[model samples]
Target: MINISQCYSTGTIKGVSKVGGLIGFCSNTTITDCYSIGNLEESPGWENAGYAREYLFRYFGGLIGTTSLGVITNCYSCGKVADVPYAGYTQYEYHGFMGPSEYGDENTVASLYFDVSKAGRTDNFAVAKSTQEMKQQNTFIGWDFIGIWRIGGGVNEGYPYLLFSYTPSEGLNVFIITDIGLKQVTEMYLITDMGLKKASQSNIIADTGLK
Candidate 1:
């Protein structure tokens, strides 16, 4: 029952096996309008690499390690995929965006894409595009631009950014405006699924000089 809507990752993810930029392992879930652009690296210092590969399941991807029995749409990933280069004990699987699944493939995903330049590999798991193509808005079709996503305007380094993109660790959506002279931030708003709520004064993260 895992459902992730309009979420994204802009950092790094490290793990031994079943590692992913967004989700490690998922099933029967629905992920839409999501993406990840973080370097995925293998974490050393564990049991035997071979032994662990069987136990941990050597599966890595840019968005999800493995998934099935679900739907994914309008999702993309642009990150470097890394894993145990010499796991001879067992076989390791890696993909630009996703790995194995119970009953799904490229058909199960609509408008799913991955950046070949960044991920360093391309597979049939998802659509592969160049770095420059990824930055273009036209590359992402059948996506909600006005409501869910925004690109350009110096947003996310030309990458598509969710209109309300914010992880739980980032507190909440605290946008800056010019109404307050653009010199300081004295306001904050809590964006909920229902709608935007005028957050209380306590929601203000900071009210000081901007520059």
Candidate 2:
């Protein structure tokens, strides 16, 4: 398990088998405001007893190798990850933020952003910005935004939205608005499973609006 906050990593792995930036194998960790730039590759190794020799299983990833349960927020990754030349079936997967292999894993973002323009090149990994203020602010364009989900550029086509499954007994019941524009507006509605309720002007608007 690994917990990273505000960091960056990059490089190339020539013959390494299992490789990753933030983590090779993760479990129950939290990563925030981080970035990864690199190319992770698998080298030729001893073939497993049951596995075939022709197909090499290479594990290469950007943010993580395998995540069972964890939380990743406000992070991004730009790199070329290739799992080849190994002695098994290769699974090549990349993420601008994180790589999750199981359910119940939480990936959250509030004013987070990512640029994967060079994802398939150079094997670069970097955290360009560490603070939430670095993201370009805009209005929420009506979409799902929540926990254990991904929201940002590249995958979501630059449309920010929360993604996650619902679990009632987790924590406090609070509505969170991520858009800076939405937080600036005065009139808004509190949406819930039951119905929509008008939010107080003071509640929706920030302190600057109050003045």
Candidate 3:
């Protein structure tokens, strides 16, 4: 399966529809300890102007637009979701955590949270936390602080961050989402312009330039 671990997205992510701050769409993958502080908003001057707002899906999400057969855990997002116009569209839905899943099941979504104050709204897939509560360590009850994540100490406005992003070690790794002509499979191989390579070999290669 595709493994996305300890990843995050920042800044504003604007689009016509189905916009996700971290991932626009994914399926059958495992995402853990990830977050998105980026804002999700509908692109200006691009709504229903000669186009039908009746598109099958019109959504904006903090982490993912739609994920099916996926497992998400220990993830959170504190992003603003706004400027979407879908007054009469039945499929119009937005969320601070997720847009939708193929099976419409929330079982695969676990340990997920969102800052309602920043997001302005939320969904059933994730729990809502106020801005103040999001900054407190006690708010994340079962999160790992000693290893994968850390909070406070003037970091991320006290929001949790991946530990390896701050500390230098052999464990530091960064996985770039493949853009291999839009076709992807739930496999361990990363096929890029540099040629095919195993996911394990990619993960073990240190990013020594991190500072």
**Winning model by TM-score:** 3
Each model's TM-score, in the order given?
0.70, 0.42, 0.72
> For candidate 1, what's the RMSD?
9.9
How many residue pairs collide in each prediction?
0, 18, 0
| Model 3: pairs clashing at backbone N, Cα or C within 3 Å | none
When summed lDDT is taken over every stretch of 10 residues in candidate 3, the lowest stretch is 177-186
The per-model lDDT (C-alpha) reads: 0.72, 0.45, 0.72
Residue 153's lDDT within candidate 1 is 46
What lDDT, from 0 to 1, does candidate 1 have? 0.72
lDDT of 2 by residue, 73-107 (tens): 65555555653443233333443434445354554
Off by over 4 Å in 3: 48-50, 88-92, 102-107, 167-211
Error of 1 at 187 (Å): 22
Model 1, residue 91: C-alpha shift (Å): 9.7
Residue 116 of model 2: what lDDT? Answer: 42
lDDT leaderboard ranking = 3, 1, 2
